[model samples]
Target: MYTEENTARLLPDVAVHAQPHLVGELDWVGMDGIEVPVRFDAGDGDVQRASARVGAFVNLRRPDKRGIHMSRLYLQVEQALSTQTLSTATLRDLLRGFLDSHKDLSDRACLSIRFEHLVRRPALRSANSGWRSYPVTIEASMIGEELLLEFGTEIVYSSTCPASAALSRQLIQDQFAKDFDAGKAVEHAAVLAWLGSEKGIVATPHAQRSVARLRVRPAEGAAFNLIDLIDVTEQALGTPVQTAVKREDEQAFALANGGNLMFCEDAARRIQKALDADKALSDFHIRVEHQESLHPHDAVAYASKGVEGGYAGKGCA
Candidate 1:
């Protein structure tokens, strides 16, 4: 068996860090798509353990260093995640560990984690419920001793076009006028039957599937409130997609969509207003996309909290 001392003597050890000829500081260097097991808090005092895809990086401040200890960064992430719950404090510790491991070479560290968060959603008008998965991403960066945390998620809903709805009402009114006679008594049952017939309902509004993607940074010392943000968004939109559905639930969903006719601009503003009301969030960026049924392309709008030097209203592609 070869010992550590014998191996070092037999092998050529290249001092890459000592090479001054190839000296240049790198903005970022490390690993991406690293698989790790992490524990997440569901904001209800429940802890969920799941596998997540992670990315870890650090900025090389030393010009003479050839490269960073990539394996050390990976190990640090694994160790930190295995020992702590997922939160702002956990992320700050993990990022600090990255810099600690590369003390002489790096001064700034960053980490990103992506996972699918599953939550149970009840039916609109039924006793049953089902699980819905939301794509979530958590990112953190540490520069010196300051750490910034960001959270992102996506919500899918229905958007009924306001223009199409008005047009449809006009057509229905025209159909009803043609079916009825001027100054004539109409039977209640006959009118009800006519309203249910195809001729009476000549047109229907066009509604399309829409998505709201948001990224937010919570205020300092505030806990990460993922479920609270989700609730606020769904309530503000008023037509979130349902998981479990019976006939009654389907009917309730239809009524909800009919009542909440909106354009892409409307959805974006609703989310912006809801986020503004939450004191826990300090900065945010939101984008709502209406996959138009009338047009081949999608209509999109963006909004932000407009904090100085914070996130701009950018598209989430």
Candidate 2:
């Protein structure tokens, strides 16, 4: 019953997208919080599938256009992500698709995908292992013909205040001097009993949960190495929060914290040094936050590769 003429009359062709606009070229116009399934190559012959929150955008070069085809961006993102394993090459193609769909309306496009990356981490002193979720984000942008990619992640660890540790040690030494006369003969049993008593540890250093947020851009032809970057950061900090821990593991963690006392400055510097040694990352920005147990506010430090037009080393908090 539906002929071509009747169908054309029933649904009229609308040109709302070509409506006149007053503004000039807009910087970015697109959609955010689009839920999509993405596949990632783990670099070890493994592929990880995750549901991610995606943001897609493009620079609207034509001021006369009413708006960009937002649904087109979403559809392109969904199709590409569902079909291909994410990589620099695939991401470039995806962004290119954004421009292709828009054609003469846009020349620059950007995409941001955020998800939690899970890895099984072994206990510090136990045979057990548990999954740890690291919050991660991948950002890709194409300006004209140039494509830029950045990988970011957040790592949580323990930071013991170096100044607080030194002060605690001083107090403990003073307590020990008071408990046992320096010139008197120190008996083994008496020293052991004193060490076991509450008076022995007159003070304790303040340690608190800390976080390191890092964003890095890999060099040309380099792959996005999320796991490697996480490992390097955790190793440098020396006190990543554990998932499964027995008494021995807890003690080992305590020992690690004690040995690697750091202020926010130290934490940032350690990560900076480690990242600098890595050849894969061409530019990076690091922010370390020491949630102070002694103060109401947190202590924070930020560092960035001193490259021209690189990250500005701004603190997120």
Task: Compose the digit string of candidate 2's lDDT tens values, residues 1-317.
Answer: 78987986776445345655455788999999999988886555578898999999999888777678888899999999988888999999999999999997999999999988788889999999899998889999998789999999999999999999999999999999888898999999998998888888889999999999999999999997778998999999999999999999999999999999998999999999999999999999998999888989999999988788888645464
Between which residue pairs do clashes occur in model 1? none
Q: Name the runs in model 1 displaced over 4 angstroms.
A: 4-22, 313-317
For each candidate in the order shown, give its overall lDDT on alpha carbons: 0.89, 0.90
Off by over 4 Å in 2: 1-21, 312-317
Q: What is candidate 1's lDDT per residue for 1-317, written digit by digit as tens? A: 68987985776546444576777888999899999888887687777787899999999888766788898898988998877889887888888889888898889999999988888889998999998898889999999999988999999999999999999999998988888986899899988999889987799999999999989998988876778888999999999999999999999999999899999999999999999999999999998999989989999999999888887744355
Query: In terms of TM-score, how similar is model 1 to the real structure?
Result: 0.94
Q: Cα miss at 118, model 2 (Å)?
A: 0.7
Candidate No. with top TM-score: 1
